[model samples]
Target chain A: MVKTDGLHFQYPGGEAFDFPNIDLSAKDHLAVLGPSGVGKTTLLHLLSGILPASSGTIFIGNTEITSLDRKALDKFRGSHIGLVFQRYHFVKSLNVEENLQLRQYFPSKLKDKERREAIAERLGLKAHLKKKVTQLSQGQQQRVSIALGLIHKPKVVFADEPTSNLDDVNCERVLGLLKEEAKLCGSSLVIITHDQRVTEHFKNQVVL
Target chain B: MKLGFIAYKNMVSKPLNMVLSLLLLVLSVSLVTFVLQLSKQLNGQMDKNISPVDMVVGAKGSPLQLVLSSVLHIDSPTGNIKLNEAEQIIKHPFVDSAIPVSYGDNYRGYRILGTDPAYFERYEAVLQQGRLYKTTFELVAGSAVALKLGLKIGGKVVSSHGLAAAGGEAHDDKPYTIVGILEPSGTVVDQLLICNLKSVWDAHDHGDGTHGDEEHREDESNLGNEEGNDHTQENERHHDQGDKEHDHTPDDDEHHHEEEHDLHDEEKEITSLLVKFKNPIGLVQLPRFINENTNMQAALPGFEIQRLMGLLGSGVKTLNGIAMAILLVSGFSIFISLLKTIRERRQELALLRTYGLGTRKLLFLVLFEGLFLAFIGFLLGWVLGRLALILVSKYIEAAYGYVLQINGPEFVELLLLGATLLIAIIAVFLASTSIFKLNISKTLGDA
Candidate 1:
């Protein structure tokens, strides 16, 4: 579960933000609906502990993540949180399956091939797992990003505008796949996006 | 999925940058190693060929040339010295041994050196085939000479007039017969065709080119040493008498034989003498005494070889400097490549950082790339250096008759290997400082 109370952020240049409280349990989902430049990405970054909150409490289970040091927070984020961004990223030298399995290397040195195959099969990425990500279609590449995020089985999946670059068909198909895969892994889903269509599928919502 | 594999793949991802840097690194390291090996081998060869000679007494000329020709046998002789004067120097109390050397002829560019049997003892040479030559005009061929010429024990060879392979002027009248072959000595002795001193005098100074019963009988005995039969000697003398080449025939006169014996003791000339001293005092005093008192000049090989190495050292030093400059340039190339690549792949690094790969792991990834390059550079450079020596050693053998020993990497080359890795470590660390300051939030946000 992920929870945040009185989350406030202040950049070194004095730009500040005050956020509302959020509480979500395992297998629960939330849509952070907002337009561009309204702190949607900032809230995701603060909740994930990528950027420190000025005066706030953020928890990924019983652990308050903001109080951890840089190294410990990195490890905590790796094992507990999954991040998927809109601009697709993959190690160019690696194939699709290697890119997905590489995420497990951050928190744990052991390989988890059963989870990798399960995620690939559910997302319709099973056929293209051995191919280079560059050779895949844009939709397939976005699905690979999802596999990379959840291959380690984190506590909550945080995706930033994952469906923003898709047309109507792919946009709803990707949003549906994200929620379904999060339910299969028994993890909370957080889709932070400007797309109003995502709010239709996710009943639990927050306007940042 | 290993970090090491990622590091390797990322390093080779830019083939242009990796190949450009690796080529220069390999060239510089190979050149430096080759120069060090060649210079060390040259010094080693000179020291080995010095043997036990304290001084060389030869005709007046450049001391370097005297040392090069008499001691190393790689240069032409500086004319001939009188045998009588050289024998007088050998009679001095400080002299332990003096081996008279006379050579002005070659068989296929292999020198036919005339010296006493004590010359073998100086180099510790042993017979590989047959017995030593106990008479005049019988040859004991060196291992290289026999192998190159396909010479057997009973083979006869006629020499040309000069030191090199001259076309005409062949001394076909008095051919020398191979009586023995020396084993491989790893010295200058391995390249010569050695015979008794009388062989040279007979080839060039046999008066009137005629022979009598007594002299012709002695010739048959020497020629038939391997087969000591009276019937064979009679047949050999009879066959030679019919060929009109019975030891330089001129009108078939026999009276000049006695006058030639007179010429042998008084007017016979030799090129030089390898003089070994009984004590260290002669090394300091003998060369000066022979130079001031006798008509011959004395040269100390140890001093001359040092000067020769000094002249060669300056050239090797220049090549080493150029090679070092190239190595420095290669270090900077790798540094700039890693640094520029780290900046260009900022988003990729940001993704890795966001996924909880620590700054230390990122640093190690970059360092592993450098380690891979250094390992390949040193290994290939070391092998290329030795392979080049094998090729160049052929040329060295032809020019100087000395084969440079091709051994494995010694202590100095291991130090070079150590230095190559150190350069990579320094370059990688300098390029990796930005990895610590990477902002995952800002970099991922920018994308």
Candidate 2:
């Protein structure tokens, strides 16, 4: 459950832009579509509590993130939100299994072995779980990043350009895995992407 | 904590860079260690070189030079004074005891000292062989002299005509019988030969020895009837002319006794005196009294050692200062490297930040990297410094005859090293300000 009322943000030394008010609840999948420079990623970052809003009241389960200090906000984000980046952001030195294990560094109750195996099975990453992130193919790394996003079973998953690097089939597989993991955890999914192909999987759409 | 380990792993990925940094740190630390150890060894040798004399009553000269000559055996005596003057000074009310040392002969570059039984007692020297010199020709050799010359008790060894072996003519008939060997004290005495004052007199006494001054008769007579072993190799080649020149045998017995006493009083040949007061408190007063009242000077061991430390310590401090500067520069290098690394990993860090790592945790990651490098380099340098000290100790002991204790790095050293690491880590954190200012939205958009 999340909501933002008149959320506004601006790059430092730039004019502020206000985002339209929006709301989402359990198990709802929202596709955020916008041009490259229209702050699609900014909205996702703000929703995920990774960026401060110039003027906003963002709520996740009735708690305003804008008022929290950097430390408190980080703890809040770790326990409640899972983020998937456009490019594969898996640590270069770690294997897919280790990348999944990184989720445990946050305050979470996910069992390392169980979460890794389940995510690998769902995303078809089981065959390459022990391979270093750098050693994986671009498509495989993207799958690993999506797997990492769902490993902690957060209440909400925020994806920024999640399908940009995936091919047609890999894109479908990545989106399918994200939706399946969200449904399994009773979590809502919000994806920001310039690619129009990902819109087919989500019932809800918010175009900027 | 997990992030800290991750940061450390990433920092060590460039093994060559890590090794280069460690090598620089080791080089600087080893230099500091070497200089400190050398100064320590030198100071220790200075103390050990000064032996049995409670007071260095000698002709006016630099006290340091006198100490260097008489105790260290490194220089010649100031000038010869009468033996009676030394004896009278020794019998003074405040004087506890005295040893008369006459210097002349050398065997293979080692100084040969003619001294009395008091030299042995004052130095707590033990005879390792036959006995102390019972007669004029008997000699007591130091451990090094015995070993280097291959001489043993009861063996015969000849003294060169002078201090140098190459220039001095051999005094074959005036051969010395090695009657005793001194136990090793790891001091300057280990490189000398100790004989009685009469032996020094007899070696050059033309009547007893075939080799005597033949040419420089005027110089010998200029000595004012004072008996000395100042008979050099030049005198040996020239004393033939003086073979029958001054007939001191014509002088009356009482006049000769008075002449001998005055000669002994005038030929004061002590290089330096090592004076000690009944109490350490007398240390301050005695040096002042000696410096102001007489031509001779006195020096307090502690004050002189401190002065020497100050003079020598400046060089050491300058070197340490350079080391510290390099350490600081390396700290900045580490900081810049880690900060640049974090900036390059902004998207990755932002991803982690989104996953609950805050600005503080991200900053901590960079800080941990800096600390990790410093800690490793510090440990490496400490071990390297100690190993360098051990290697240098052997060479110093052999060269200076002073046993240096190279063990025991004090707590202050460890504290200083720890502080250096702490500063390096802080520098890394400071350099990571760029990472702290990273904007997640801009980063993700760029990615």
Candidate 3:
């Protein structure tokens, strides 16, 4: 579970924002809807402990993420929180299987080839396991990005504009896979999006 | 799966950039290593060639030229001095030993020296075959001369008029017999043919068996007269003898001994005298005394060799500086390449941070990349240095008869390799600071 109270942030020499409180249960999903320049990515960054919240408390599971140091936050974030960005950023030199293995590597987790294959099979990436990320098509790359985010079975997964670049059909398939993967891992899902089409998919939603 | 694997992939993905940086590094490292090896070898050769002789005394001329001619045998002699005068100098109380050398002839471009057995003893030369020269017209060839001329004991060689002269006047009436061959000593002796002083006198003797003093004075004034004179008288006397008569010798010991004494008394001249002082006192007093009071010039081998090294050292130092500058520029190039790589890969680095790679691991990844390039460049540079040394060794040996040992690694090579790696690490660290200060969210959001 993730809980945020009186969340607010002020960028240096820029505007400040006072965000609404959020109460998210495990295995649930929240879509943050906003247009451009509305601090949608900033909110995700703050709740994920990537950007420190100026005046608020964020609790993921039992630990208050805002009270953690940089190093502890990094470790906590890596093991318990996952991030998926709009661009599907990956080490382009690595193949699909190796990319998943990299996520497993940093958490000091055993490289379970069976687990990797299972995740790849679920995302329909089994046939492209040995292909470099750059060789994959847009839909295949999007599924691989979801696999990367959920590989370690984090308790909370935060995605920033995950479907902005996809068409209506790819966007639905990507969102369906992300929600199914999040439910499979029993993790809370927070999707930050500017598109209104995504608002109907999540019952619990936040608007900036 | 490892960070190193990722770093390697990132480096090889842009092969052209990595190769350009590596090539510059290899060139700089090889240049420095080559200079170090060459300078060491050249200095070693110079030290080995400088014998233990304290002073070289020759007829009045340039001291350096006299030292070069008398000690190293690489220059023309400074005319001839009277043997009696040199003998007086040798008898001084402070003199330990003196060996006089007489040079005039050559056999197939190898110099023939008329000196005593002490010359062989001075060089620690051992006879590889046959016996030393005990009579006039008997010769002992050095190892290089024997090998080059295909000469053995009892072989005969006619002397030419001048040192290293081809098709010059030949002493056809009397040829010197090779009596001994010396082992290789890595000295000037290896290129010489040793004979008794009388052989040179007999070969240049132009008088008609009558007045020895007049002949000596005539030979002293015009050393070339013997070469210009017709060989009719000397040839006729040798040609009339039958083969058995030519091989015969006088049986009476007393008469042979008297003849040897008479030959010694004849007006003999030598080109130069090699002197060694009994103590340091002679070093201060002998050269000055000889220069002020005698007709000969005394050349100090140590002083002359020091001057030569001083001149060559300046050149070596300048080349070493240039090589170091090239290495510094190579370091700068690596810094720029790494900086550019970090700039281009900022988004990817941010992504890695989100995946749980700590800042320290990221820093080490970049550091290892630089070290890897340095290691490869250093190893290739070392091999290239050895190859260059092989080429230079062949040339130096062919031109100067000095061998350079280039097979082993020196201590300086290891030190240089360490220094190169250190510089590479520092360069990488300075360039990778952009990775440390990167704001992950901003970079990823911008991307």
The top-ranked prediction according to TM-score is 1
- The TM-score of predicted model 3 comes to 0.79
| Best prediction by lDDT | 1
Instruction: List, for all models, the DockQ compared with the true complex.
Output: 0.70, 0.47, 0.59
C-alpha RMSD for every candidate: 7.4, 6.8, 6.7
lDDT of 3 by residue, A1-208 (tens): 8899999999988989888898999888999888888888889889887788889999999999999987888788878888887888988777889889988878566588888999899999999999999999988888888998899899999998888998899889889989999989888899999988898899998898
Pick by DockQ: which candidate is best? 1
Off by over 4 Å in 1: B166-168, B206-262
**Cα-based TM-score, every candidate:** 0.89, 0.74, 0.79
Please give the range of 10 consecutive residues that has the lowest summed lDDT in model 3 chain B: B226-235
Error of 3 at B134 (Å): 7.2
User: lDDT tens digits, residues A154-199, model 1?
Assistant: 8899999999888999998888888878877777899999998788
Ten contiguous residues minimizing lDDT sum, candidate 1 chain A: A101-110
Instruction: Give lDDT tens digits, candidate 3, residues B14-89.
Output: 8898898888788878888998988877666556555668888888877877787777777666677778889988
True contacts kept of 1: 0.64
lDDT of 2 at A106: 72
Q: Rate residue A46 of model 1 by lDDT.
A: 93
Comparing candidate 1 with candidate 3, which one achieves the higher TM-score?
Answer: 1
Query: Which whole-number lDDT from 0 to 100 does residue B317 have in model 3?
Result: 91
- In candidate 3, which residue pairs get closer than 3 Å at backbone N, Cα or C atoms, i.e. clash? none
